[model samples]
Target: MAEVKLHGFWSSPFSCRVIWALKLKGVEYEYIEEDLLNKSELLLKYNPIYKKIPVLVHDGKPIAESLVILEYIEETWPENPLLPRDLYDRAMARFWIQYGATKCADAIGALYVASEEEKEKAAKEILEVLKILEDQALGDKKFFGGDNINLVDISYGPCAYWLPALAEAVGVKVLEPSTLPKLHAWAKNFIEVPVIKENIPEHDKMTAYSRSAREKLGKN
Candidate 1:
């Protein structure tokens, strides 16, 4: 058996992505929960550049960044594949995942710390980015990977789970049936997956945490 270990924080969607990938692939890994306030020395040692959580250590090699870890998990396991087998499909999947990482994520983060006067603008920006994703990448597919969850889905896990909590915390609605219906449905289906449902952070707890984070950000 391969020695696998994961360093992560509980409330982070990025950490949840690694957990979901490991569970889906049936790879056994020891999970180490790190406090973001005071990061573990091992975490700092492993991810010297970023010093962030969601670092996966397979055997003795350490891989940092959630998306990078997800790819490593897929390539390492290869049994229950998280990426598409087709070359073009794989490329497209990666493209959408990158899009979410770059475009959608910024808007969502902006919304989280937006002032009362800036709230509407920030919310609109996220909605617009998500709408593009819904129409272009997702379309009518049940999942980003069509029949099953894949890297794309895992990459956007925050949009499914954390975004709603952040919206609630910041007093704005982004993913709603009234606005982005398809994406809204996608969120519902994504979370209901047994691996996702079982592994995700508690919603109420996350919402409270987001509220506190927003307040702290406001102070800064």
Candidate 2:
């Protein structure tokens, strides 16, 4: 048995991504919550350069970056496979994972501000990107890896868990059933998965935190 520990912010999608991966693999680990505003000295020291949460400390060695951490976990546990077994399929999975990561910041930024015009523009752009995901990546797949969730779904973990709360906080309906039917439905299904369901932050709690963050930033 190896000592496994995680440093993360409870409300962070990045943290949640790692959490979901570990749980999906049935790996035992301890969770250490971090304060983003006042990052722990340990977190900064462990991840000196980035100073980001969701760092996995395994047997005393630290691994940062949620996506990279995910690959490490999948490689370590190997029980429940997150990436596809085929080489090409694996590459495709990684490609989509990176795709989601690139788009998420813009999607989230839209709601992070309070300007009505900016909000609308952000929402529209975000939804447009999301539409491409549904139309191309997800299509009619029940999960990113077919019947079950995979690294691709995990990569988009934040979008599934946090988008609804953000929509409420920003008072918009961007992920509507009509607009992004497949993506919206996939989000619902993804959150309902056992591992993700148990590990996610509470809905109301996230809403409050999101609202407070926006207020602090003078977004409202």
Q: Which tens-of-lDDT digit does each residue in 1-117 have in candidate 1?
A: 559999999998899999999999999989899999999999999999999988999997999988889889999899999898999999999999999889987998788778888
Q: Write the per-residue lDDT of candidate 2 for residues 46-65, one digit (tens) a residue.
A: 99999998899999999999
The parts of candidate 2 lying over 4 Å away from their true place are: none
Kindly provide the TM-score of model 1 when superposed on the true structure, using C-alpha atoms: 0.97
> Cα lDDT of all candidates, in order?
0.91, 0.87
The residue pairs that clash in candidate 2, if any, are none
Residue 167, candidate 1: Cα error in Å is 1.0
Cα lDDT for residue 127, model 2? 87
